[model samples]
Target: MRAPRDKVIITCAVTGNLTTPDQTPYLPITPQQIADSCLGAADAGAAVVHIHVRDPATGRPSMALEYYQEVVERIRAKNPELILNITTGPGGRFVPSADDPKVAAAGTTLMVPEKRVEHVTALKPDICTLDLNTMNSGKEVVINTPGNVRRMAKVIAEAGVKPEIELFDSGDIALMNDLLKDGTLKGPILCSFVMGVRYGFQPAPETVIYARNLLPPDAEFTAIGIGRAAFSSVAQSYLAGGHVRVGLEDGVYISRGKLAASNAEMVTKARRLVEDLGGEIASFAEARRIVGLAPYSATRAA
Candidate 1:
């Protein structure tokens, strides 16, 4: 039998919470913008779009089901085969008390585990992320304790949604592994190494190597290297037997000292990297097959 082609799945995270228009003018916020960004990424060779919705009016993070519905509807209207990976990760940010260390003031958005997965259950996305670590994420602390991870895992498993176990460092892989052994995570595993964010995993070949080594063999892994570590880490990830993630969510720049005009540009660059290294890009159907995600027959576009 002839050997199958090595296919690299390109995932584009459309919009994020932390970045603002002041930082980058092209970051998508509204449903139309997010959907457009996904379409652009698809045309640029991306097989998946990982989404986090924002308030259409203020551009702040939103958990409203309608917002997610709009984004999904718009994307599916164009292509039902494109994979949609929603984020259940926004509600976990904890910016501890600025004045007193004892009392947590505002700036935190921690929710009960069930509350966090509400959108996942309602949206029934192809895949969704369940961040598995509690880390000092910049000025804020992003938390996902054992109890919450277990709770959310059950909810995701019951909803028949693939949880993309998001980790920031090597220890996180071990922690997620522990959950599997404990029977908390009960479906096919997908991992994404979020690198270069301050106070998170530093982006480098060695760090990626260690992190990748810690993942379960049954796991399918990808990388998102933010800020200055973007392209270099993606290159390293492909070199290390993994896929790459790109978009306004990960980095605002197309190159050092230059800004990216859109998420499509990011996907285009990622495609170039995979091809230059002799790896083929996965189509939407192929990506679903590789990631073990069942297609959502619930498409409104259908």
Candidate 2:
């Protein structure tokens, strides 16, 4: 394992496209709620806030540009320093129809590469996710072909937003290397190992370590364990020289059978865990530098 850094970056995934309000009342739905969640997470020691917007009335995931614009504007107005990582992984889902394999089934959101990255280009966030692999995400197939990935990577890079390559399993690492070799992605890459989603890598120390070993030496990575493995993955990633991400997007529960009150609560606990391990939490500016982002300036829009 590589040597652990003295400082760790904590990212809070404020809201996700998957989970709904029914599963947990604490999930942020409206733009105001999402913005507020980001602020709370930042206050709780999270340097970066990963966001996914939802329909305020229906509480369903939305790719509407206005929703994103409003959310980003609100967060920027209140906390300009926090790094925002918007999701470009939402429209890649494809559930093929059993009756007609050529056609998409319900719950499929397959989109053109240009449309998938429209928000990133428009908003110019500090960072935007670039999912490097296509695999089964529960019942639906999350489609990210090599061509699509390259296209999205190019667009994101041209927009001046750092791409956080997201990997669900070890196989995804090969794709990451390909992107690096092709120059679609640059060095000191920021990767996130998302574990324990259905059909994805199971959350375990060995799994986390194996994935970490595949990364480029100069790359910085974070690990997130879904549901029950959330906290354990955080500890393992920290011990193995990686950063951490947590929030309602990954898991709603703070503990077994108990739902987290908010994103802030999860971040607070992450801070304590890092501290208990004798690690210092990285500030927003420090996190930007560590991830190869330019220093934040007040004149810069969030």
Candidate 3:
């Protein structure tokens, strides 16, 4: 068994690429709301806030740099201590056309690898996600080819930001190990296991244990559950010597027949759960040290 961590880090994925406003009225769409939600999650004991921006008017996921700048500025103005983890998860989904399998369908967001991390390069956050999955999602496939991932990693490295490797299956873990071996990604890595997605790593204790065992000795991981598994994975991940994550992006409901009123509500529950489990929540500074992030002032000046 991996040694248990003294302090648990709760990461709140305030908004994600796939989650829509229609799924939950409480989902933050505007820059102001996203920033406000992030700040609230921080106040409720989340040391890190995972972010994705959406179009203000239509509530569609956007890769616009302007929106990211606005949200980051707003959050930093309020609480610079909260670690910001921006998403590079957009612009990777592929929906093939019915007539021409090679051609992309209307929902396809696939773009050049460089285009995907444009915001991360320009508005460098403390950490940015680097997805390593090429998996089937319903009828569509999310593609993150190895070569493209390296190209994105190069840009992320140049920006001096930490890459939070998001693993969806056992293969992604294998790929991460390879990346480490080949020096594509540096060690003392930070990663997350995204559970409960259809055809991805299912939410289970064994799955968490299995994935956790595959990671490098120094890797810091969080196991995130989607839909019904969200809260349960908080305890599952913690017990398995990993961190936890929760937000509307992973699930809309906090409990059966009830929606989480805000991301802060979800973080509050996660905090209570961890404390109940005899684990103390990591403060922002402690989490930064654990994740190898520079202090807030140092990051800003970079």
List the candidates' TM-scores in order.
0.94, 0.98, 0.98
Q: Which is superior by lDDT, 1 or 3?
A: 3
Q: How many clashing pairs does model 3 include?
A: 0
Candidate 1's displacement at residue 266, Å, is 0.8
lDDT of 1 by residue, 118-143 (tens): 88898788899988878887677888
Q: What tens-digit string does per-residue lDDT give for candidate 2 at 1-302?
A: 68777889999998898887889989999999999999999999999999899889999999999999999999888889899999998889888899997899888888899999999999999999999778877777888999999999889988999999999988899989988998888998899999988888888889888989899998899989988898988898899899999999999999889999999999999989988998999998899889999998866762
* Per-candidate RMSD, Å: 2.7, 1.0, 1.2
- Model 1 CA deviation exceeding 4 Å by range: 1-5, 98-102, 295-301
Q: Candidates' lDDT values, in order?
A: 0.84, 0.91, 0.93
| lDDT top scorer | 3
The superposed Cα distance between candidate 3 and the true structure at residue 39, in angstroms, equals: 0.3
As a TM-score, model 2 comes out at 0.98
